[model samples]
Target: MHNNLHKTKENTSLTTDSEWAITHNNLTSVYRLMGDLSNALSHLQIALEIRKKVLQANHSIVDVSFNNVGIIYHSKGDHKTARINYQEALEIHRKSLSTVHPRSAETYNNIVFVYDLMSDYSNAVSYYQKTLKIQKKSSLSLIHPDLATTNRNMGCTYAALGDYLTILEFFEKGFNIRKTPLPSAHPDFAKTYKNIGSLFNKKK
Candidate 1:
């Protein structure tokens, strides 16, 4: 698909820069999903450069590119670079979107992950709180997957800080949310139980 999209460029009348940018972005997603981080980053950068040339700096698409790049960096364990890209994405989202918007929440969540990876428990918790606030205001159900994931992540962070009681609280919150929507045999539900058991073992 990537090559086919490029081939369309041969007939300039048949393709626009925006089309090329979208194709590159799609390719980036495909590569990222395949765990080809290098290719994903390359395609994402191409898309970002193209969009920057053709669109406004604060365009939502531009913000998406920045956020996607940040996610790649985060996955690569380059927490500093990831945080920088996330901050840029957050700034753009804040300027163009409501505080309670899902995109903003996503950026907040990304930042939380970065901070967690960096072992900055305080910062991680702070961003997690921001993410929760946005999710709540957006009126997402308690059992929403993102909310459950966030709760789980917060529990892990608390566990890392040796806050056993707090960890249990967040872990139970996540488990309860998952238990209703997820079947008993689902991996997510089982994982939640596993996490709770691990916390107990740690406490012992």
Candidate 2:
């Protein structure tokens, strides 16, 4: 949020910051917060183009470009394109950062989502496991949404693979975690309970 606010502060040199990347990035963040995804995507695409022209393709800045555009594609329901872009970001992160870096975790998480959207459940499960492993290694176990993501995705993957026991195990863990960390009526907790109930109904 601070970045979103301060991004427009022109340089002290009495001139606009003519850096192509920064301007597009600031616009992208602002548009994203405003729910204007089309504008956000457009700005991010411009940012990526400029970064690629100025920096190496595998650099962190280039990786961010890939990630930002990939997210836009995902939000727009173009999972195939999203997967390719996420793969590019994943490769860049693997080559440049340690495996458990938060950036790498983000790439892994995005890839998992793309695979899930494509109905590639096996690959999705594999990526989700890798994502949780990275998050756990980062020692952010209490981060609500991420913790919920790990549990819910792991449960769904197990359910898809016909491992009902593991599905129940993870879903219950997620439910308990959410109930304690979030208000009991939080949507996350409610959704978890609904899923568990549905799963049990099928077994009856």
Candidate 3:
């Protein structure tokens, strides 16, 4: 992934356009997926700097940049940085988009996810409920990807709380929603199933 990014720098003449932006973004994502977080952040920082300069700061690309960086922090288990980045993205969405915009819901869900990972289940539920509120009001369907994410996060919270029944319930709800809207064998659903099995195994 870093190798690909170095290739991107090779095309200096192609610099600064949205096309270049996408290459850099892809490079950033690939590095993160490959677990090279430092490399990911370096390219992401460069891409984000370019994004801020090339596109309007409030453009959706800015949101994407913020989101990508936040996700890296989340994956790295840096809850404080994840929380701050999510709030930053949320602020950008709120300022640039409509009240019930999908992007705003996405940001809310993103923050909620980090809260769950941080073991702050109460705040996690608070934000998921907030996302649910906005999702219900939107013209979008109840089964939107972000909505499902919120539900899955709720399930994960229940799992963390050691309430297996509720965990199963929310996980099933989330899984059912995603089954049609997303791929059948999605990793999130796989996670829920794994959690269920792990809980039962421990009890035995």
Candidate 4:
């Protein structure tokens, strides 16, 4: 995938076509999956630059580029930088769509994760609430993977706050939501199970 995208990128001028930005974005994903975060960030930045040049400042796609770049930074453990990029994406989303947009929810989720990493559990829960509100208000299904993820994350945040019963409720809800769509052997299940197990231990 990386090689194919690299070839496409070489053939297309960044300013001339949006495909060039797409190629870079694809390359960024490929690199991210490979755990080459440095390369992922570089490619993502190129894609962001291309998108900014080709699209309006408030364009949704430009916001997507920013959000994706934030993801790479987040994976790299640069929580502050990730938060900045996420906030930028959120601002763009606010400009481009309604206040309750799913894109805004996604950025809120990203910010929640960063705050979680920063040990700002209060902020994480606040953002998670916003995320859930938007997801529930949007056309997303009740059992959407994103909803499951937010539930699980919120459970973890509650766990950090030593709210064992609340954590269990959230964890159970997330588990129920995910069970239908995600395979039992999925990696996300592993994390959820670990969290539940730890919750039990805490209760003991």
Q: Which candidate is the best by TM-score?
A: 1
Error of 2 at 15 (Å): 16
Poorly placed runs, candidate 4 (over 4 Å): 1-20, 26-35, 143-145, 172-197
Tens digits of per-residue lDDT for model 4, 1-204: 657756665766543468887777787778788889999899889888877887899998889888988888898889999999999999898888998888798799889889988999999999999999999999999999988988988998999999999999999989999998877898888888899999998889
Q: Worst 10-residue stretch by lDDT in candidate 3? A: 1-10
- Candidate 1 lDDT, tens digit per residue, 1-204? 667667777567523378788877888889888999999999888889888888889899899889989989988888999899999998998888888999999888889878887889989999998998899889798779888888889999988889999998988888888889866888887788799899888878
TM-score of each: 0.80, 0.74, 0.67, 0.73
In model 3, the clashing pairs are none
Clashes of each: 0, 0, 0, 0
Name the lDDT of candidate 3.
0.77
- Alpha-carbon runs more than 4 Å astray in model 2: 1-18, 27-42, 142-145, 176-189
Compared with the true structure, model 2 gives a TM-score of 0.74
Order of quality (lDDT): 4, 1, 2, 3
Q: Provide the lDDT at 92 for model 4.
A: 91
| Pairs in clash, predicted candidate 1 | none
Using TM-score as the yardstick, the better of models 3 and 4 is: 4
In terms of lDDT, the poorest run of 10 residues in model 1 is 8-17
Winner of 3 and 4 under lDDT: 4
